[model samples]
Target: MIRGEAYVPEEANDVWLSVIGKSLAYLCLKQAEQADPDRMSGVLAKVKFLMGLGLSQDDAAAAAGSTAQSVRVMKIRKRSSSGKKKKKRRTS
Candidate 1:
């Protein structure tokens, strides 16, 4: 549905859809990692993004080799953080 050819039901559409979804998710995560190598959390963000795009949370987690429970936990932790900055110490 995202600027690609639509598959017909008789042609194993679900299989093709799942494949495309996983590939797109992987590409997104890879690009994010390239921008921030220290952040493994990018994968979880990718999963959530895919879910927002209509893929089931279970399918997204499966594509990432994780569980829905883990995804929810990560999301909760991410949101619970306060966007406050720590004071920087100056050294001569």
Candidate 2:
């Protein structure tokens, strides 16, 4: 069970929603200001795009933090799920 903030879609024409999203993005930017302020603008842009895409909360958060695991990571566990230990297959 993953836990994080919730993403709620606002009306397409909701002025306040747009404002608030932008505001929150701005706050995130400010929090990360020392790292690279210019990049914050890009973050803001991506956030807007994700919101437009209707991504779920977890997806958006991962995108925002750049913490989304790569496809390889997601599939790695499956590769080892066969349960045949490599050492057992080797004979001296």
Q: Candidate 2: misplaced stretches above 4 Å? A: 1-13, 35-92
TM-score of 2: 0.26
Residue 61 error for model 1, in Å?
1.8
Candidate 1, residue 24: Cα displacement in angstroms equals: 2.4
Model number with the top TM-score: 1
lDDT string, candidate 2, 1-92, tens digits: 25886655566548777566656654554566656666545543445445555654445545566533542343355457867555556678
Score each candidate by Cα lDDT. 0.73, 0.54
Worst 10 residues of 1 by lDDT: 37-46
